[model samples]
Target: MYTFKFIPRENIAQIIPFLQILDVNIPAETLEQRLNEMFDNNYKCVGAYHEDRLIGVSGLWILTKYYIGRHIEPDNVIIHPDYRSRNVGDQMVDWIHAYGKANGCVASELNCYTGNTRGQKFWSSQGYEIKAFHYRKMLDNEL
Candidate 1:
């Protein structure tokens, strides 16, 4: 059996290695910036651990608009590769969804890369849909 907890910032260092294992693209500076912004914006971070070892991390942001009262985005969700296929990911998603709902979120949105078919399938299984296709372009430094 596994245990979970919402680790405080003082305990964040213990999870650095776990985050590295997940290979998430968030850089330290970016992470720090987001942490500060989230504090200012009232966003929150929740994590999961097993036997006192960090196993999963998720970042959530709440959005409010004139047309939409409140919405949420599961910006990042990562589980150690070794722990995949054991329903940890699904449980994480469910927890995030429930957290969002309880915090006044009317809906949640997430985007998975086209190449990540497994993730696409998982989200689909969780009842998310292909709302739209996103496009991005990188400009030359000279431009």
Candidate 2:
């Protein structure tokens, strides 16, 4: 059985392992520092637990955009490999939706890698449709 809770910043460390599973290339210390910085900027994390151990996590950022108005954007969603195919991700998504509505968000948005067909399918099942392409470029030197 799994339980869901809004994790506080101090307990954010508990999410490092799950985050690593999603992006193994990130250094642990860098992830920790970044999470802390996000928390300082109003980012929130919700976690799924099984028998007192965190097994999944999702991070949310509340922001206002002209296209969507006030919205909840979820990032860094992950479920431990051991717990996949058991609806944990669905539950987290459900929780995020409810939370977004309760907090006056007009919409919820998330980004999924184009290659992650399985994840895209799941998001589609949850009523999300692609609206735009996200682009990024890494700077080799300070601007």
| lDDT score for residue 31 of model 2 | 89
For residue 4, model 2's alpha carbon misses the true position, in angstroms, by 1.3
**lDDT agreement with native, every candidate:** 0.71, 0.87
Error of 2 at 57 (Å): 0.1
- The candidate that wins on TM-score is 2
- RMSD, one per candidate, in order: 3.6, 2.0
Residue range 16-123, candidate 1, lDDT tens digits? 555454445656655555466565676566777677667787767788766557888875577888888998888888888888899899988876777878878888
lDDT of 2 by residue, 21-73 (tens): 76788888988889899898999899989889888888999999988899999
User: Candidate 1's C-alpha lDDT?
Assistant: 0.71
**Relative to the unseen true structure, what is the C-alpha lDDT of residue 99 in candidate 2, on a scale of 0 to 100?**
89
Candidate number achieving the greatest lDDT relative to the actual structure: 2
